[model samples]
Target: MTTLMTVLGIAVFAVGLLISIAWHELGHLSTAKLFGIRVPQYMVGFGPTVFSRKKGDTEYGVKAIPMGGYIRMIGMFPPGDDGRITARASSPFRSMIEDARSAAFEELQPGDEERLFYTRKPWKRVIVMFAGPFMNLVLAVLLFLGVLMGFGIRAQTTTVGSVSDCVISQSAASAGKTACGKGDPASPAKKAGLRAGDRITGFDGRPVTDWDTLQNDIRRTTGPATITVDRRGGDVTLNADLIRNQVAKSDGHGGYVDGQYVSAGFLGFTPAAGIVKQGFGDSVGQMGSMVHATVGSLVNLPERIPALWRSAFDGAPRQPDSPMGVVGAARVGGEVFSLDIPPEQRIATMLMLVAGFNLSLFLFNMLPLLPLDGGHIAGALWEAVKRNLARVFRRPDPGPFDVAKMMPVAYVVAGIFLSFTVLVLIADVVNPVKIT
Candidate 1:
């Protein structure tokens, strides 16, 4: 039964991925047509076509590979320096440029001279290229908002789940010495008569509504303190001496980091957890933090390649922060279904996974590198800058920027991306990251 559920989860993710790819391509097709560019094909996948249909001037199709999709716009590059689209060159780099220029005009029609992509103003070209990634960004934001406002997130509450009987050093706790022994001092919570299921209401005369703020308040004080709790529907205040002790450090999200200890005031109680829905402002703030974190991950991607290589071949443990390919993501989706959680939680997690993937697509495509949507946008912007400078200097029009010249660089970037993807695939299969 678990295996079946896992397979079902993977299938669901695959469908969502295909939809995302198709949606991305639709943005390109619509904006290109809107700008009067002739788009000959709108494909949702790569490799051999499994299904296709001709609608107007566009042939819509789905290919065998479910990785990515593209739209073919006619005359994407301008003619060569010799004013000929069929020009041949001897040098390898020049040949790559000429080849790209030729492919851009391969579907040229009788009236396509006015509809070529390169013939449009630089601003229009920029819009056509930027629309695709922007679509992914929009989808990501909507999905994230849905998950946040609809399903809510599991978070720590002010209620106590467990209380320690006696104080012990973090090192001793790590070594399986958690049980209270002879001569052990009673913990502050225990001495103050704090018990499980008691809801913490106030600390030092200040109201406590959340666990994180309460935790920070506790850590900052070390001497005499008062804790107010709601017991049997009555408010009870207890007095105790908060001792300075070695405790595990928090991970900044109401969770503690393993093997990381610091000297702080110890409260000796674990907070309860519950799903709490967030308001629009809070959800937006969380989304902003996610975007910042995702950008940071992309920036530090190169530094993680060596670790990925070791994990793929040396039987090393996969780091939680390691980049994951589509395969790894699908496996995680499957695991989400197999876990013994409530149905709503599983669905929420799966939706969050898809949302994160869409967000990654948006950020990844925005990179100003060749073969990516951002590269074309950058090229168009540069052309606009050059043309404006020429107009200011009272010189002849410089014409459209020959983006085909960058084909060689694009090929190199594509190769690097492919190799990295394969490495991630190997690591994912060998030592996948586990949620548990």
Candidate 2:
């Protein structure tokens, strides 16, 4: 049954991935057609076509490889400096440029001269190229908001799960010693008669519905504070003298790690965790936090390659913060499905994973490098700048920037990306990350 669940989860994730790829391509296809640019093919994968249908001027298809997708726009690059598509050259670099230009004009039909992608205004071209990543961004935002506001997130609530016997740091609690040593005083919660199942209503006369807010209120207070709890259908009030104690602080990446201790008012009660629906503002804030973390992870990717190599072949344990490829993510989805939790929780977690994947796609595609949507957008912007400068100086128009000239650079970037992807894939298979 567990194996079946894992397979089902992976299959579901694969479907979502294909849908995301199709959605991404649809953005480009729609925008290109809207601008009268002829898109010959709208493919949802990279390999041989598995299914296809022709409609209007576009051939929509799904390919065998489900990794990525693209829409082939006619005349993606402008003609060469001589105002005509050039033949292959002896120089490898020049041949690369010419080959790209030739492919762009391969499916050129009658009246396609005006329908070429490069013939469109720079702003329109930008929109056409930017639409793909923007679609991903939109999908990510919707999924994130849906999961956060609709399904809610697992978080600590104000209800007390357990009360400590005595005051002790978290580190000490983790060392197999539950009881406080001699000379240690009873915990404030225990001394104040706080017990499990008591739902805290207020701290220091400040009403707090959530554990985080209540925790912050408690941390900031140093003296005696009035604690109101809903106990057995009645409000019970108690006064607890808070003391400055060492406590663990948030490490800011979702999980708490060993870090500098801070002096805060300690309340020695563990809050019960529950699913809590967040407000729109809170959801947006969480999305922003995810975006920040994702960007940081991408920026640190290069620094992690060495660790990935070690884990792939040297039997090193995978770091908790190690980067995950699509395979790792799918495996995680499978694990999530096979967890001993409620079905709703599993669905929510899976949706969150897909949302995070889409967000990563949006961010990754927006990088201003060749073979990416951002690269074409950058080229269009450069062309616009050059033309505007020429107009201001009463000089001859520079025309559209020849993005084909960057074919060599694009090839290099693609090669590096492929190498990194393969490395991550190997690491994922060898030292897969465990949720626990």
Candidate 3:
């Protein structure tokens, strides 16, 4: 039964991935058709074609990349003097001034076939280019809404669950100085001192009603500080020595930075099962905030690098954090699925995750850099401005932008992609986030 469940999970994952890609591409196809742009080819994936069929004016094919797909519109690049498809010299379809006309879906069969992508207006072309990312955003929103409308979401409370003993080293509770003795030995904690079942009242005067709150205070003091625990009768103050231990800094999606660690004062406290649910609106807002915060971190990564680099690689002050790649992401996904919640709640959680992922893809692709929807949008706008100026000066419109010029951006994007691929490979080795 476990093996059967595994196969089913894999199958579902594959199907969902493909469906998302197709939906994204459909946005472009639909917009192109709406504007009378000839879409000669629509494909999903990146490598050799596994399946293909021709219908009406377009040939649809699936590639092996399994990551994403594209809608090929001819005439998207600048017109070259090399003369391929010309301006309606005699025919609108077979113009010689065309060699895959810029922003134009002009790639007809080697024989003589006609589809008109170049004739579309500038605004229309812009819409077509933007549609793919827009679709991804829409898909994410739908998934989020579906999940929330189905199984409800809740905010984690500061409530304690169970107390743990023989604490493992990591985070605050793991420090050598912080790990409490099996029983309350006459050690530093017992001396300075502390006892089991002591409800930590505060740290540095900050009220600590729960373990997490106490942790936050401990992590803030990496060296030494005072901890006040509310005993059965009164508050007992003791000095705590903080220690640093390697802990997984989760990147929302199960990805984490392993070797590096966060430090906190250990209290040998754990929790037992009991949680408080947040309001509906607050729950939704929390999810939104999570997505925004994570994406913001990724976007601001450029500024966070040098310091982070020195810490991780160079023996400089220390490293901030590094990114986890695909492997890390997958491990997180598996872990989330592994949680022993009801099937409906599990499904909702998974869908919520996919929705967040798609949202990131949509926003990231729209970043006006090269090799993205924003780049294409920029190209189209530039061409529009150039054409308008030419007309004002009594010269011919410059037509569409050149794709060759955009190759540099594409190369850079390719390099970025390759770097992430390496990260993914390394992530598998560093700390694979496992389910159960």
Tens digits of per-residue lDDT, candidate 1, 1-436, equal 9999899889989998998898888889999999999989999889999999999999999999999999999999999878899748899998889999999999788999999999999999999999999999999999899999999989888899999999998978898997899999889998889999999999998999878889999999898899999988999999878999998898775578899999999878888899978779778988988999999999999999999999999988898888999999999999998889999999999989999999999999999888999999999999999999999999999999999999999999999999999999999999887776
Query: Which candidate do you rate higher for TM-score, 1 or 2?
Result: 2
lDDT of 2 by residue, 301-390 (tens): 889888889999999999978988889989988998999998998999999989989999999999999998899999999999999999
Angstrom error of the Cα, residue 183, model 3: value is 24
Per-model CA lDDT versus the true structure: 0.91, 0.89, 0.61
Of 1 and 3, the candidate ahead on TM-score is 1
- Indicate whether candidate 2 or candidate 3 has the larger TM-score: 2
Clashes per candidate (backbone, < 3 Å): 0, 0, 37
Give per-residue lDDT, candidate 2, residue 29.
92
Residue pairs with colliding backbones in model 2 are none
| Model 2 stretches with alpha carbons more than 4 Å out | 169-178, 250-257
Root-mean-square deviation of each candidate, in angstroms?
2.7, 1.8, 9.6
Show model 3 residue runs off by greater than 4 Å: 1-7, 81-106, 109-118, 156-284, 302-327, 387-398, 434-436
Provide the lDDT at 228 for model 1: 91
Overall local distance difference test of candidate 2: 0.89
Error of 2 at 180 (Å): 0.8
